[model samples]
Target: MIIAKIALELTDLLVCAGVFLVGSVISFFLFHVALRRKREKLISEAEAEAEVLRKEKILQAKEKFFQLKAEHEKYIGEKNNKITQSENR
Candidate 1:
């Protein structure tokens, strides 16, 4: 009878252990899913910021190009005026 009682106790212990193991596995899966979502959000935000920076850089470059073009045209105009004056003299 004592042996039967011990066997029953052992079975109960094993069942409890199995329950604990299953709970742990479920928790681990939930934690991993949450972390994956967080990582994706961070990556998306970084990509958006990078796109904004790229657009700003392009706009700055275009503005600089226009300024340089205007300066070049002014220089050419001045040179032409000087040559014409000298030829008239």
Candidate 2:
């Protein structure tokens, strides 16, 4: 009778342990999936921000180029005017 009781108790313990292990595995899988999704979201946000910054920098560079070109043209015109005045005199 004692041997039978002991065997029954052991069987119950094994079943409980199996259930706990399965639950842990499922929990771990769910956590991993959540983490991956969060990471992807962060990466997407960063890429969008970077694209905006790149476009802004390009616009600023174009503005700078235009300003420099205007200055150069003004300088050349002034020199030409001075030469024409000297020729007239």
Candidate 3:
């Protein structure tokens, strides 16, 4: 009878240990999947932000170029006017 009781206890302990190991493995897998998804989301958001910044910088550069072009054209017009006035005099 004592031997039978010892065997039963050993079996219960092994079952509990097996359950604990399986639970741990499942938990690890779930956490790994969640973290991977979060990482992907962060990477996508960063890429989108970079694209927006690139577009804004391009627009600002174009605006600056147009402003400079207008200034140059005005300067040339003023010089032409001066030449015409001197010729008429």
Q: For residues 1-89, what per-residue lDDT tens digits would candidate 3 score against the true structure?
A: 99999999999999999999999999999999999999999999999999999999999999999999999999999999999999999
Give per-residue CA lDDT, model 1, range 21-85, as digits (tens). Answer: 99999999999999999999999999999999999999999999999999999999999999999
The weakest ten consecutive residues by lDDT in model 1 span 18-27
Which portions of model 1 miss their true places by more than 4 Å? none
What are the Cα lDDT values of the candidates?
Answer: 1.00, 0.99, 1.00
* Deviation of model 1 at 15, angstroms: 1.9
Question: Which ten contiguous residues of candidate 3 have the minimum total lDDT?
Answer: 4-13
Reference-based TM-score of each model: 0.87, 0.88, 0.88
Error of 3 at 53 (Å): 1.1
Candidate 2 C-alpha lDDT tens digits along 25-75:
999999999999999999999999999999999999999999999999999
| Candidate 2 weakest lDDT stretch, 10 residues | 4-13
Highest-scoring model, TM-score: 3
lDDT of 3: 1.00
RMSD to native, candidate 3: 1.3
In candidate 2, position 38 carries an lDDT of 100
